[model samples]
Target: MENIISDATRRNWDRLSASTDGKLTSRANKQKSLKKIIPVEYLLDTAKIKLIEKICESYIGYSIPEIIYSIAVILLQSEGICERQSVQDILLDFQKENSIDLIQIDEAIPRFSHNEDFLGALYQSLLSEGDKNKNGSYYTPRKIVNDMLSEFDLREGQCFLDPCCGSGAFLMGVSTKDPSSLFGIEKDPIAVFIAKLNLILLYKDIDFIPQILCGDFLQDEVFFGKKSSFDYIATNPPWGNKTKIVSNLIDSKESFVHFFVKSYNLLKNRGKINFLFPESILNVKSHKVIREFIILNQDLNEIHQYSSSFTGVVTNFISMKFIKGIKTSVIKVRNKNEEFYVEYTAFQHTENKVFSLLKPQEEKIIEKVLSKSAYSLSSSEWALGIVTGNNKEKLKSSDGPNLEKIYTGKEIDKFRLREAKNYIHYDRDSFQQVARDEIYRAKEKLVYKFVSNKLMFAYDDTSSLFLNSANILIPNVPGMSTKTVLAFLNSSLYQFLYEKLFGELKVLKGNLMELPFPKIDSETNNTLTMLVEEIISEGKNNQKDIDEIIYNVYGL
Candidate 1:
C-alpha cells in the first residue's frame, strides 16, 4: 500500500511536469487503458498544493519566473503521462499559450546559474530575513497559518492585509479564502515577488499585483495614506531585544513601537487585527508605550498563550484580536489545556473566570484560591533583573582548570538554572569587579544575597521575572527550601495565576513580587524542602533521576 501511494505520488509529479506533446499521447493511452482511475480531488485535496509547491521547489529552483513556469507546466499536464519530452518543446508550447515571453523565463534561470541555486537562495533568504525572526533561528511553522485561518471567519469581499507579510504565507492563506480582496505588504523585494507570483497563479487580476510593496510599513507614506482601508489585518511580528530596528525615515529605538501605534489608524472602526506577537510587549518596561497605546486606543479581545519551552524556533506566541471602542474578553490557553477567561474592564482592571477542560467543579475551588491570592509575589519586593554582561575575559585560554560556574539568560531555562560551560568564579579582583559591575549592579540588584540560613530569593526588575525568569532559593528555612519554592513556582496553580493576571504578556517584576505565596504548615514545608534537596543531590549524579524526582513530586 505504501509503495502504491509512493508510485502514485511520483506519477502525479511526472504528469504535472510532462510537456504538451507528451501529455496528449499519455492522456490518449491512459483513456484507452484504464477503466476508472482515482479522482484528482481525492488524490490532491488541500495538501496537493503544498506537495506540488515542494516538488517544484525541489527541482525547478526559486526564481519567481522559474516557479511560475514550473507551476504552469505542472498544471497543464494534470492528466496521467507515461513519457517526457525535451525542455525546449515544453517551453515553446507554454510561451505560445500563456502569451508569456519564453526569453524572460530563460533569462531568470541563468541569474540562479541553475534551478538548484535559485531554490537554495530563496529558501535561505526567507529563513534568514530580519523580519523573519520569530523565535531564535526559526521561521513560523505553516501549521500555525492553517490553524489561525481555520479558526477565523474570513469570507469573500472582505479586505485583508498582512502588514509584516514574509513570503506571503498569511496572505496566501487569506487568498485561499477570498482571492479578490487579499493584499499584502513585504519589505523584502524577493519575498514581495514570490508572494505576487503565489497570488497570480490562482487569480490573474492586474490590480492585485501592485498591492504588495517593497517598503517599510512604519515609515512608508503609501501605507499611512491607506487609513481604515482593511477590514482584517493579520501578521506575526518579530520578537526579542533586537526588534528595535532603525527606520529609513527616522533614527530612533522606538520605530517598531510607532509601527504598532500606526496599525490602529490603518484599521476601520471596529476592524479586527489578529496578530501573533511576543509576550514581552504586554508587560516589558521599555515597551510600555506600545502597551499604553493598545489599552487606550483599541479593545484587546482574545489571547492564546504558548509555552517558553516551545521557544527556540517557534517562539511563545500570543494571538490577539483587537477591535476598536469595545471592552474585550481575554481568553488564555496554557499547555493546550487550562483555559482562563477574564474580562478587561478599564485599564489594568480585570474580572476573572476559570475555564477547566476536566473536572468542571474544580473551577469554583480554583477561583476561590485565586481571588484570595490574586497578586504577584514581585509586587511584594521580589524584584527581577537580567544577567546580561558575561565575564568573557575570565574564560580559560585553552583547556585549563575551570574555576567558577556562571549563569546567563540562556542558562535560565524553563524555571531552574542549568549549568553552562562558559563561566568564571569570583576569584581575582578584576573578575570580582566585572561580576559586581555587570551581573550584580548592572541594572538594579535583582540577585538575592542569601542571608545566613534565610529564604533564598532574587529580585527581578524585568517583566519576564514572574514567568520563571528568576528562581527563589531559601536557605535554612525549616519548612521552605529553595527546591520547595521552585516546585511551587513551577506548579499549575502558579501558572494559572500568572495567566490570569498577565494573559500572554510578560510577567513583570512588580507582578511577580505581588503574587501571594500559599502558606503551608511548617511540617509540609520541611518535607517539601527535604524532598527538593534530595532531588537536586540526585540530579548531580543522574539527570534522569532528577527528572523522575520532579515527576514524582509534581505527580506528572
Candidate 2:
C-alpha cells in the first residue's frame, strides 16, 4: 500500500509538471507528450487513494474524498485515459472490492475541489453537453466576486456560508480573507471536494474543520437548523431556466422559493448576503415569493447591474447586497468611496437600478431626475411577457414556410440584426394574425416571436429591455407602423437617453417607459411614418438607398 501510494504520488506530480510544460508548447507536441506519460490504467491502491484524497482535501480546505477521486478521474479523462463512465465503473469497482466500508462517495461528490482543475473540467463538460438550457451553471468571473467583497467591510471572525456553493469558489474566496470564518453547503459532492481541496491548499494555518454539508439545500435540515449563524453569505445562484432540477417529490421553482425563505431565516439580523442572481428575479412574476420576502424582511442595500444582452450565456446578472434588521427600502451605492443613499419611490424597481462611479455632473442629472419622478414610468405597466413555452413548434419550417425571415433576440448581434434563415411558420392563418396583433398591442403578451418584414421588436418583460451594442427596437403609439416607431426609438436622442439613464447595463422594460422621448408633434409622427414608408420602398428596390435613408434619419 505504501509503495503504491508513493508511486502514484510521484506519477501524479510528474504528470502535473508535464501537463504544465505541455501547455507551454505547440498543440501537436503537447498531445504527443501527454499520450506517452498519462496512461488509462494508472490505478491507485486503497492506501494511495485515501492518501491522495486527504492530501487534496487538506490542500483545498473543505471537500469530500470522493470528489477528489472524481476530479482525478476527470483529469485523467481529459487526457483521454478514461471516459466518465469508465471512471464511474472504476470507482464502483473500488468500493465493491472494499465491501463498501469506506468514505461515502455520495457525500464526497459535493466536496470536490473548487480549484481551476475541477472548475475547468466541469466547464468543459457543461459546454460539451450544452447544459445551459437545463442546469444554468454559468461561471461567475472571479474579478466580480473580489470587487463585491471589497465593497463591503467584512471582519475576520464573521461566519460565512454559500448555500448554492458551486465548487466552493465564493467560500474559497472567503477563506483567503479569513479561513476560520468560512463554511459552505453544496449539493454537488464533486464540487464540495474541489472547494475543500482548494481551501486546504490556500489556508494552511486555519485548523477549524470546514462546515460544508452535502445535500439538497432546499430540503436539507442542516441549513434550517442554524438561524442567523452566518454573518456573510455570498453566492452567484444559477440563472434562467438552467440549473432547474425536476423531480416527483418537488418542483424546481418551488425549491427556489423555499431556498429564498430559508436563506432569509438563516441570516442573523443585520447579516449581509451578497448574491448574484438573474435580473428576471427582480420583476418576473414567477419570483414574486422571493421579491416579496426580501421586501418584507431585508433591506436592499446595493444593486449593480451588468448589461444582459452583452453577457452571452450569462444574461442580466445583478449583484445585490441585502442586510437584515434594517428598514425595507432600496439604497443605491455609486462606488466604494461613496456611501449608499436611500431613494424612496414606489416606482423604484431595485432590479432595474444600476450603480456606477458618477461624476459631479452625472450626479446632478440623477438628482434632478429622482427629485421630479418618485417612481419609474413603467411601475404600473411593467408586466411579464409571454413565454414561447416551446420553440420547437414555432421553429419548424413545415408549420410556417415564410418563418425563415423573422428574428429573435439571438439573431440580434451587436448593432446589426440578422434574418433568421430557419424558423417555424404557423399553418393556421388566424393564429398567425393573433400573434402578429398581440406583438403590436400596447399591453402585448408576445412570446419573443419573429415578425415578417418587420425590423423592430417590442417586449413587455424587463429582462429584454436593455440594448447592449447599440439601439434596440421599442414600441410607439398603437396603430402606428413599426417603421415610424423604429425611426424614433433608433434616433440618436433616444440612444443618448438610454446611455445617460442606464449606465453600462441594458435598460429593462420598467425603465423603457420612463425614457424621455423627443417631443415630436403628432404631425411630425405622421411625417416620420411617411419617411419610414419611403425608406422601406427604397430598401426593397435598393438596400444601399435604405441604409443612406436610415443614416440621414438617425444622423449616425
Candidate 3:
C-alpha cells in the first residue's frame, strides 16, 4: 500500500514538475523553494492528521501547537499585540523544531496558496491505501473550490454554510473581501482546526469572523437553530456514509442524501444551494426518493457534470445549483472532459420533472413511454446472493463431493451463466442468512449481475447458489416468462431507460421493481422464448434479435 501511494505521488510530482519545468519550486521562485529541499510530495492519513490536531489543540504553545493557536487567536477572534507576538513566536518555534537553519517568510510565501493551505497540503500528502474508504477524507482541490465560490457570488450579509466542510476549503473559498455571513460544521476536529486557520487567512484584513465548528451535522439538531435560515449552502459532503434515522433528512440510507435534505431544509425559501455531489444522485435507486423530492420541490439553475473531477476519486460528481422556491426555467449543463469543458442545455419538459444530461427530445421520448403502465421489480420475489464474510478463506477451487457450485456476478453474462470458478460449502452452517437462503434454494429462478453498467441476467434451473455480486429473482408477473424477462433486460431500450432513469451502475432490486415490462401475447412470448433459447444455447449476446422483437411487440 505504501509503495502504491509512493508511486502515485511520484507520478503526480513528475507530471507537475514536467509541466512547470521546476518553476514551481526554483530558488528564483522562493515560495516553491521547499521543493528543492523535499523533492516529493506526501499525503497524510486520518490518524496522522488527527495527531497533528492533538499537538496543536493547546491554547498557547510553540511549534505546531503555536501555529494552530496563533491562527485561532488572530483570525478567529480579534487582532491584538499579544496575538501578533504569539504568531511570531509560533513561526520561530516551528522553524526551530523542524531543524531549519534559517526562516524566510517572504521567500516561502509563494509555495503555499495561503497560510491555511499549508494544512490543506499536509492532509493531501500522507494518504495511505483505503484510507479514504475508511475515513471519508478527501480534500477538495483549490481550482474546483475557487470556481464554485466565484460562480456562487457571495454577498455582504447573505449567509454561507459548508455542512461537511473539510479543512474549511469551501468556507475559505468564499469571497473574503465582500464576505457573506460564514458558518460551517465539520465532523473531523482536525479538519475543523484546519478550517479555522484557512478562514482566518482568507479573511485576513477583513473584519468578519467565520463560525466554523466540529459536529456531525446529521445527528445534531443544534446545527440548525432556525428553519429556513441560511442563504447559501455549499460543500462536498462526506462520501460513502450512512444516515442513522434522522427525521426528514433520512429519506435514503446513503449519508450524502441526508446532507442534501438537511441543507435544503436549512435554506431560506428562495435561498440557493451550490454543492458537489456524486452523479449517482441523479439516478440511483436508493436516491429515487431524493430525486423525486428535488423534482417536485426544488428548481434547478445549472449543473456542472465533470468526468474525473478529482484524479483519485473513482465516482463521477456534479457541481449543482438549485433554487428552493422557483421552477427551473433555463438549465445549463457543463460537462468537463480531460482537456476541455463542453456545455449542453438540460432537456426541459413542460410537465415532467426529470433532471438528466439527456437531450430534450430523448427525455421527451422516454417520458412518453414512462407515461404508460410500469411495474416494480419488487412485485417479484428477489433475493441477494450469499455474502461470505471472507471469500478467500471460505471459497474452494476444487470441489469436494459435498460442495456446491457457486457463481459470482463476473461469471454471469446477458444470456448465459458461465462455469462456476469456485464452490461453496452448502452445509446448513456454512451459509450465513442475509436475506433468505430459501430464495437461492429455488429450483428455477433468474439471476442477474448486481453491479453492472447494463442489465445482465440469465435463467437458472440448476438451483445453484451464487455469491453476493449476483442476485436471484423469481418473477411474480403472470405471463412474462423468465426468457422474455431476460430478453427485455438485455434489450437496448431497457438499457437506455435504466441508464437515464436510474443512473446507478449497480442494478439494485428497487430499479428492477420499477421497470415497466410491456405485456406480450403468448405467440409473441413464444417467439421471444425461442430467440432467448437460441442465444443461450449458442452462448452469444443476440441483443439485436431480442430488441427487434421486443420493440415491434411494444409498437415502438
TM-score of each: 0.50, 0.49, 0.68
Give the clash count for model 3.
16
Select the stronger candidate by lDDT from 2 and 3. 3
Best by lDDT: 3
Q: State in Å the error of residue 230, model 2.
A: 1.7
For candidate 3, report its TM-score: 0.68
The residue-by-residue lDDT of candidate 3 on 265-363, one tens digit each, is 888888888778887776554566766676566486677876433433446678878888877655667764422211122322211223556656566
lDDT for model 1 comes to: 0.44
How far is 532's C-alpha from truth in model 3 (Å)?
A: 2.0
Q: What's each prediction's clash count?
A: 31, 47, 16
Error of 3 at 469 (Å): 4.7
The best candidate by TM-score is 3
lDDT of 2 by residue, 1-556 (tens): 2232244334543543423212222223222222211111121133334443444435333233443454544444444434435334544653454343333323233233233334323322223213333444444545566656654455766677788776666765554466656777776655555555455544534434456666777556655354447777778665543345444332336444455556656777888877776666655545655666665554877776653211123244567777777875456744324544444342232354432234445445545544433323342222222234455555554324354333455554312334444444433352322223223244422222222212233323222221111223334444334454555444444444455544434445544666543333466567665665554444322334434443443334
Judging by lDDT, tell me the better candidate of 1 and 3.
3
List the candidates ranked by lDDT, beginning with the highest. Answer: 3, 2, 1
Q: Compared with the true structure, what per-residue lDDT tens digits does model 1 show for residues 425-475?
A: 445344322222233323322233221112223322231121123433222
